[model samples]
Target chain A: MTRVHDMGGRYGDGPVRPEPQGVPAFAADWHPRALALTVAAGGLGKWNIDMARHAREALAPRDYNRFAYYEKWIAALADMLVSEGLVSRAELTDGQGAAPGPEGPAAGPVTVQKVRQMIANGAPADRAASAPARFVPGDRVRTRRPAANLFVDGGHTRLPQYAAGAEGRVLRVHGSHVLPDRSAHKLGEGAEPLYAVAFAASALWARPEHPRDEVVLDLWQSYLEAV
Target chain B: MPHDHSDHDHPHALLPPDPALRVKALETILTRKGLIEPAALDEIIDTYQNRIGPQNGAQVVARAWTDPAFRADLLRDATAVVADMGFYGRQGEHIVAVENTPEQHNMVVCTLCSCYPWPLLGIPPGWYKSDAYRARAVREPRRVLSEFGVELPEDTAVRVWDSTAEVRYLVVPMRPAGTEAMDAAALARLVTRDSMIGTGLVTAP
Candidate 1:
């Protein structure tokens, strides 16, 4: 019997590969399958021509409300994936499960690249270590206008268009890099940690008067600055 | 095809009107009549809700509840803290948090969209997100509460929070009647979800 572990964890196409015969090597392996699953779970199954038409119609002016409605459909796609077994419940719930144990039935080594790919591929994205947070609770900060995509809907996606670059304070540090729950269903790899970030109001607005007028946002680490 | 009210929720009913057509309608009526331009209306909507909405109320309530010396702070700096929380996104800059006291209770509504205080309170509840709650929250708030099985004393003042623009509102319900003896988590439980929206108050059960 030839040992496959000698290849340094890379999925090589050699005859000696033993056990777990059909696993794909890169994160993009199951893209189509995953997308199909997402679409199905997002309530797009059976293709409601009328509903689609309405949603398309609603998007003519690109208002946030239309986007919110679209999110429901996207969420339905994620739900379909979970039901169909293309995505596992463990994967969905373990966006922060880096505790060095059995990851799953197909447990294998995880890499930072894999983590990034999971996020890009629509899994939930937690906090990233590349950009560590500087401010803590009691520290004041301002929201900066960073360039990013703002989805107006409320499904498995990133920050709402209405909340991009909004500012606040650090209410609590939910450990290290965790997934941002908002996009976790679409971007997570089933077991990783995403960071949690909080922002305040006075930091974002000008001359206003309430003290507790503070708002707390659970942001990914990638969405922060020192100020 | 007879118009059947019973079969109204046939999935097709949920479909919304087209945006371009709605925009055209507004343009023809408002812009042509010199009432407003498309860009101007967009800017106005954005500014009203984002720069001056719910964050305004939260700041006022938070300040007053936290500091005895800041009643003036509550009134004057509503949106300032909203800025602090970076609540200045697309439609949520102008914000406010309302306080519900022993003498008064506060509730919020958005005659349009489910506009809410996303920065502070997270997402709005399913009930608040429903049209029934929004439509009745302002007009017959007391009656709606009765439907939810919540009855208030006749003498208690009721304040309804109507959110226009992106100015959302949160009810800082007076700390529960006996909540002074409780901890934060304990207080949190007593802070029923409905109480935060001003539809109900926390009771020590």
Candidate 2:
């Protein structure tokens, strides 16, 4: 159940190409518009950030790979609008209004002034820590191994496939924060203590290309166990 | 094995290839539904395109390079220190400033999604979000750094920070030599976006 979006440590994707000098923030004129649309629609308070990510991740593998970056945003935003009952598929396809949209508890349409305020006051995910952190810096820990089913229910997770079950040392303790695994599934924030775990290069890959190199991941308390 | 094309029942195949047209249609429909405001969309685009960007990150790096106290504060409590500079916003709610010394080099990547510090660095660059980078940066950082024309010393340890949680990281690159006399503005100009991301290094002008 490892989705294509969880692409860490897999091979043969291709070479990295840096954008040309002084390239604009966006390549195409429509790119910024696509980003703006997604932001504005998201401001309606219909879904949280985790749900937005889940919508994009839920795309079919073929479509996920085939669509360009902003194209994926546009596609996912379209599907969310329809599925959330904000708009109808017919309205989108025909470019016409079929009926008056449902008046749910949506924060009214975002105005220009609100856009500046919202962008400055971006959504903060850090929640109040209910209990003391389980691990501390310098403590040895291991990431949780996925069960045999491997999340067939398609719950959203921040744990990449490469880091699963790897032994590492805690580098720092970042207080409680929302766990995306539950947030994406309409579950509660499930706030938990997060840690910065450092795994040596040799521990992750079969061959030690750079023995001293290391990879650090911000893992939740639930994802780690004392080793 | 090649992808089987026989099963062409993908629902999204009906989507128009021209994204501009699709976006326009979607916007029109959403406006009619009173779900989104066009002016708000304009403001969102303008803010990221014109106001927020790498210059903000460069300013922070410049201040850190010139002021010892500021640098220490950045490494110890980046969230508060950075917000004091008016660089607080989404994707940067919890910030960690990792400094690069002669012994250790730090790099940032989000293997899960494009989780970048938008308020400080604006939108992520195209290559930063590419599948190749997401897949290889964690496994083969040395090779990835070399591809970006950055080669570290043999003994320098490379630490790749993968953004798995909400906590975002900003790499405080080592200041280049022969720039002690330069002012903060000049020093800021020397700090590129890639340098702060740890893919490239600052060079003296």
Candidate 3:
């Protein structure tokens, strides 16, 4: 299903307001804390990044549209904490803990030093290529259309609705990486060969504003089929 | 009206608690549960707010413009080159440097989520994460560029990179003219965050 967050080529939102250079990273005091808490809690490792993304995407469309950027992060983080048995909804709502925490190998005290090290050494997503890449640069391909039964609510996808089923040319091949479709659902990593596909703006939109322009998307191989 | 003993200064209290209060409550709960550390939170905040940002990207851009070999390395394998320069981290696990030339222009966007090169450019600007940019950039990039005060020639092809996967993109904007005598640091000062995002161009100062 095309979730509300999959907003590409849709219109009438508003004009872009470029903030002045050197604007503070957080607009308000809570913004940074929200971001930091989300990152820190994520280190608990109960859920992966894709699962966290799914939690956010699962927000009701109205709520997703209403919440500010960090608000979504905070909301999703709270949901994950409760659902993962790390915290309780009562704890979140009442501003106090009501039960004992889960027993496990203590995941963290993710210290400041540890965070700094984590930042320097990022969580690399590239996994060993399960098989040879099915396509290469200069190959013609088309993104697969979502099957009617496929991608219902909670089915996460990296393929935006705008480029679905659209024909494009492969610009480059990025080796296997974790596919969100499977990872978000608690399925295996299901790494796949990713590609940079270039589609003509005219092809993506029926009414061409700039026919000479192009829209390039980095898509996993599963999302595409040989044209 | 019945005299109630709840803390209701005004009718606005009928609404949900302020996000600040909500967040503070979450922090308190998480800390109590030992799921997170406040000090680590402080570190994450400080690192993004102060240490990493567009200056890193500007320095990379400056180096690329002044050093052809470095520029070639950047365009060829941005991940290794930038890591060699010590700018590798989360949100920037894999990097691709798409150069903006006279013939073509490149812009980056993530419609699904706000995926940016945080190690290089820090947090994305508010405008980049806005609904309008995510919706309109790929469909009408020329118009979006114009809104950002960039008036590209009609002949120049605009390439909009929708970051749908793990790979993050950085636009290596063309070096401005009349700066041949300036050093890399001086040129770095002229590179704006938007230029590296493909919304604005570097102007010779």
Kept native contacts, as fractions per model, are 0.00, 0.62, 0.65
The TM-score values for the models, in the order shown, are: 0.35, 0.93, 0.93
Residues A1-227 of candidate 2 have per-residue lDDT tens digits of: 45678888889988888764222468788899899998888777777888788777777888889888988888888777766777665676677554344653244567787777778788888889966798989999998876111232555778888888999999999889887877765667889898999999898898756889999999988888999
What does candidate 1's lDDT look like per residue over B1-205, in tens digits? 2221211212211222442332232223222322222343333323333443333334434345545656444344545555554544322334455666656566665533355654444334445544456444543556566766667666555555544222445567675455456554444444544555666655675
- TM-score per model for chain B alone? 0.59, 0.92, 0.91
Q: What TM-score number comes out for model 2?
A: 0.93
- Candidate 1, DockQ score (0 to 1): 0.02
Using Cα atoms, each model's DockQ against the true complex is: 0.02, 0.48, 0.38
- DockQ score for candidate 2: 0.48
Candidate 2: segments with Cα more than 4 A from true spot:
A20-24, A98-107, A147-152, B1-17
> Candidate 3 lDDT, tens digit per residue, B49-79?
8899999999999999999999999999999
lDDT of 3 by residue, A1-227 (tens): 56788899999987888887753457899999988888878777788888888777777777689889888888777777766777765566578654334663245656777787778877888999997899989999999886111433437788898988899999998889998888876768889899999999887998766778899999888888998
- The DockQ leader among the candidates is 2
- Compared with the true structure, what per-residue lDDT tens digits does model 2 show for residues B126-161? 999999998889999888898999999999999999
